[model samples]
Target: MTVPPEPEDRGTLTISPSVVRKIAQHAADRVDGTTRAERRIAGLGLGTHGASAKVGGEGNDVDPVLDVALHYPAPVRRIVGDLRARVTEEVERITSYQVRDISVTVSALLPDIAPRVR
Candidate 1:
């Protein structure tokens, strides 16, 4: 956990990578064209459901790499741009850390199922 120093010197705060990951996941979920999926390995019995975030850099400077799933029929550029901005804003606001960069990877594209018409 690392906290940025403020002029007021209110006190020291600590933020963990897990907290960043959760923030990113929530941000991704808020995006209309994106969906978080579960990553699983049957043989290894390992899995993670929802968006994953990798935090890099030291102290106040933080870089987040997000892996998320997109729904079909979405505009890749637009969705990615929104996702990056939203995630950065949310993480920075919550942790009070400077978000240097955000990398978004589309892990999968979910198919859009239409309702059947008789």
Candidate 2:
């Protein structure tokens, strides 16, 4: 019989769309001024908000649509730009895929709350 390949050499790597979206979302959350928002429906508490992304495309080209919440009184334009760049860089770096386009939706603007010091 012929010799078999090594265990480490025989597997193919795959990066799923969900994984790409998660990576992009996590990356977006890491930037400054990006924060989680509390979600409510009809005066009921649903849950807290986090940046989310939907990734799609063929081959190694990825298109992600991101929904994010930002802090109030912050520069929205600049922060969104930063978020876009960061997401693109992180997704491409992690997956070795090209991020062709990113669509960002600013879902909410939350107040920047600080804890009181006694």
Candidate 3:
């Protein structure tokens, strides 16, 4: 049998997409009443575990965007609004990159089930 040719290795500096997602998620969760319910956003096709890196552009000069899906216990609209503002703030503060946009998609409105005070 003939030997298969070896695959060429290109030194490409690539970062997984999850990194940006995690950073965005963490920042969003830190918002007073916001929480990241699920790991991944189905429609958006964002993975739970990934990493993102800046390819190259004058050292973080380009604005980055973080798409988010939120699950709230009440007032979906209000919660979504708050999430957008908070995500933008946190990402900008931590990464020092201008937020191109924050798209907040409300996934679900869960009921606030209270626990019994024993």
Tens digits of per-residue lDDT, candidate 3, 1-118, equal 9776655553444333344456666665555544344355666745342112221223343333434433344565676577667766865576665566555544444445578895
> What are the Cα lDDT values of the candidates?
0.81, 0.92, 0.50
Best by TM-score: 2
lDDT of 1 by residue, 48-94 (tens): 46667788878888888988888887898899999988988998898
Better of 2 and 3 by lDDT: 2
TM-score of 2: 0.83
- Give the candidates in order of TM-score, highest first: 2, 1, 3
Candidate 2 has its poorest 10 consecutive residues by lDDT at 109-118
- Over all chains combined, what TM-score does candidate 1 have? 0.76
- TM values, all candidates: 0.76, 0.83, 0.49
Runs in model 1 lying further than 4 Å from the true structure: 1-11, 38-40, 43-48, 114-118
RMSD of each: 6.4, 3.1, 11.3
The C-alpha local distance difference test score for the whole of candidate 1 amounts to 0.81
Give a tens-digit lDDT track for model 2, residues 59-103: 899999999999897899999999999999999899999999999
> Can you list the residue pairs that collide in candidate 1?
none
